[model samples]
Target chain A: MTESSKRSRQVTFVRFALAVALAGTAGIAWMSFDLGIWDQSGPGPGFLPFVEAIGLGLIVLAGLPAYRASSDLLLMPANVTSILGQAAVVAAFAILMPYFGFVAAAWGIVIATAWLNGERNWLAMLLLGGGCAFGIQYLFAMLGTTL
Target chain B: MSTTEALLHGLMLALQPENLMWGFIGCFLGNFVGVLPGLGSSGAIAILLPVTAILPPTPAIIMLTGIFYGSNYGGTITTVLLNIPGEAATAITALDGNPMAKAGRAGAALGIAAIGSFVGGSIATVLLAFGAPSLAKLGLMMGPAERCALMIFALCLLAMLLGRKAASGMAAALLGLLIASVGIDPVMGMPRFTFGQPELLDGINFVAAVMGLFGMSEVFVALEQRLVGKITENVGPIMPTREDLRVSVKPILRGTVIGSLIGMIPGTNSALASFLAYGVETSVAKDPSRFGKGAIEGVASPETANNAFANANFIPLLALGIPGTASLAILMGGMMMYGLAPGPFLFRDNPDIVWAVIASMFVGNLILLILNLPLASMWIQMLRVRYSLLAPVIVLFTLVGSYSISSSMVSVWTTLTFGIIGFGMKKFDLPIAPMVLTMVLGPLLEANLRRALTISRGDFSVFFNHPISAVILVAAALVLTFLVLRLIFARSRTPSFDSED
Candidate 1:
């Protein structure tokens, strides 16, 4: 695809994201108002949120037209893989920590992350991951703090 | 107690073995992250913020502050050896530091930088010791109206002065305010945007947001930029001559003054301070052209300036409850986590903790200088650590940090969700610092404004009636006008002007 076309796609994606965010903010504002938003002395619960949501929504709308230009914002293929890989690892680590415990989950994350990013030797990965993970666990443990 | 007496008391507390150990660990890690790319003091602090969730506030604050200044000091290693700056503060050092290294005076260049940082740090800390108390005394006189105005002024000035585009910065600030309003409203005991989730009633965890924004987002950017740096094996002459000291002395003093003053302001940071110091050094030099060609002053001036700026940033944070820079904003978050707010009252309410933190810094700077000189050769090995290997480890730590906050999965989910949002914001060229700072300050702004209104019996004119509040609001209005004009000018110049960062 042309670079300009790639940029247009990214911009459209961004605009769509902004729209969703605006809608979320607006929905929240609506709900806050529904909760009964008036008091004698000053603004109530919904008052500030409503004003803030409108400001953000307007600003997001104002930022929309700027995406209409040719630009170089598309991520390269390798970077996309690397970013997505790391992100997925983070999400998985967050999920696995409850079941596996912090230290074990950490070790797993380290190994998985290292291997994903090209630490080929499984033994080395285990050593490095185990060493770092357990080291922190021990350090915090000694300090009487838990992960 | 007098400043001198309080500092003496603080010294006794900081000397405890456990506190000393934390400081040493922070310094060592500071050097490690400083030599490596991607993570700076702010990132390290965020990733480690949860660790502080369990410790006493004093030691935690000391350790984190040590890590912060130490990282800035550590950043000098790569700049002199390999021309890679760890963060903005050290970028100025690279201009002449790399040339000096190539000229085979790498040790001398590195040595003077250490000296400059130490000198700058000590000077700034001394100023902080004397400065904070006086500033706090003034703050003690302010009513709620004035405090509210001051905070708004701080945020407005920060948004206006710090960014390339004022409108985007303001938008980011507004977004932060909106995000901060997600939980229960403190005044009315009403939930605004919690979506019926009990987890959010307390609000978005600061550590989670910090992890996602500064920590995870950094990983994404580093990956995109393909930043894998190599350490130079041979760093020449690790010590400076008496002649080199003579060359650097004046520049260090000049930088210290410039950096300290800039740091006192609400928005300027060490990066700008270093650049300004370098510019001043070059312009005032007897031989202007000697710069960018291994001039020792080039390294000394900016290095000194940045360390001074880093130390001085705490002045605003401590005295006025305003964070002057991004890292300090995170530090303010750390302060909040400790159940300590950074207002004038903090000085009176938490004198021991505050003074001990200040005293620990003096010790931390000494320890950094004392250790870093011999450890320069050792720190270069840190360069061999690749960003790829580091990225996953950071994610693991970030997960632990997010979970450690509330011991809940919701915090983890919040982090990952914002991690994705932060990634997108970064890729799209938006500045996250403004957003993060505003989020932290936004609730305070709303709370204070409401409190004042409640006092005034619903008079909207109450804000404009008070002199201090009126001036601050007027200043905000002027800043807004500037943003409007800037938008108009840019729009006239280009078809799509207002949309960018």
Candidate 2:
């Protein structure tokens, strides 16, 4: 286990823990504001949600030891660039989806992804992206959906 | 009515042209997706769920069931031909089937697997037809508290089966429960986790979640590998010799029995059953050393178990309205979409539809056997296609599939987000199955727990009051204790992380 790899693993673990904690906190806060603590019907709908958030927080706190122990053994830096790039593309697709129709948005996303992944063939990319969008549109349309 | 009479009625309903057409379509599409590595019935069914809204209830359920079992049959094709287990359930088949392919006996391996699966599936279907009513009656006796305890037991059992690192599995289950809480609370009609979004008031659609987790994730992985240009091995004719058939009979019988029993338990899917069957067969075999080196029995047992368990998994869902696997969960969703509920009353009220589904399993199994044996050589040729070409198609389908889930752009985003998370998990060597299990089972656990607590007037002792529930809870506790003890002991015996592989 190299020092750099260990550091990378630590970072990943920290990020994961932080994300889980933030999500849990948000869930708890939402429950507190959205639903009362108790009602005549024993417990409100938010009771389980609140408990689940607390459980998640506990798990995040508990993950520290395992994360530290395995940090050196995991983390391959070679794939970091590609993985992060893929994540960026996914985030962009998600952000753009609401603005564009599913077909246009997905087609653009898939083509951009193929280009980023080194598919330089213009005709091939268009065919692949366009064909998929059309086919799915047809299928969904037949099923009475307009995605 | 006797089982035979019911089956006859089922056959009559299944043979109808409308139902038959849907069954065939589902089987065909299911096999197509199953042939792709890493995708399984869950992904295929989730992707197709929204389409069922337009279908009549019978055809919808029939198609969904076909996709579920068809994937079981199709997964073996890649394992035998390319040595790549399409799904975890087919992992054992690759040990021997791939070796047989390498030894110029690909035909024999594929033929035997198909035949074994057919036999196993047939027996399991017969068992389900005869057994479901009785089991359903048993479930009917359970009250709200008992049902909640039962759900807990199922979750605990899932954690146990996941083994060793139980925390990750439980966390994943908790996550699922959280997701399940997003919709209007059934008990109070109050929005719990909806975040004031009307779209979420109805809840995060199961179809979307499943599609994102299984289908989209697979696409991302496929892209990461740049799977194009990879060449597959040459395949031969597809026909099993008499010797192959003779050797497989006993293993098939054993696998069918084991698979059927395991499938009856909620959360223990075909993958676990196949793995367990393989382990049992290997241990009981005369020569255990031959397992990874190409044991025919290894291929036969797991393949048989996979198909058998796929058929029998419906038992709980049909009887108690509790799905045993992710695919079955989607089927339950389909039932709801059709304005029909799946429980004891479903059997009585919709006998034609229920019987048709059961009968179609028999028909589908027969079709799979024939397709696998005669057309396997052709299917094997699929491996020769470059991964690059397939990657684009997968990506395309995934996007479309995710989008179709709710006709909401939000779902597409959700799928993409999960895809990235899935890829990261894969890179970190975390078991993705636990996450899927969590996402699916979490909500059910929460709902049931709350229900039990409410019924008990906030007394936690209610979970242990019922004898069956107490037994299950005790078993869970014992398993957890044993796991902790074993881990502590093993720490001194071994200094390394055990290879889950």
lDDT of 1 by residue, B211-310 (tens): 7877777777776677655455557767788899888889999999998888887655677788889999999999999999999999999999888988
Output the lDDT of residue B12, model 1. 85
* Residue pairs in candidate 2 whose N, alpha carbon or C atoms collide under 3 angstroms: B172-B438, B173-B438, B177-B442, B177-B443, B227-B387, B228-B387, B228-B388
Q: Give each prediction's root-mean-square deviation over alpha carbons.
A: 3.2, 3.5
Which candidate gets the maximum TM-score versus the true structure?
1
In the order shown, the candidates' DockQ scores are 0.57, 0.45
Residue B107: error of model 2 in Å? 2.4
Q: Candidate 1: where are CA atoms >4 Å away?
A: A35-38, A70-78, A145-147, B102-105, B482-501
A1-147 in candidate 2: lDDT tens per residue? 977767876778666756766676666757654686556556667777777777766766676556766565444434456546655766676677678766787687667767656677778878887887787778777766776
Judge candidate 2 against the unseen true structure and give its global Cα lDDT, from 0 to 1: 0.71
Cα error, residue B452 of model 2, in Å, equals: 3.6
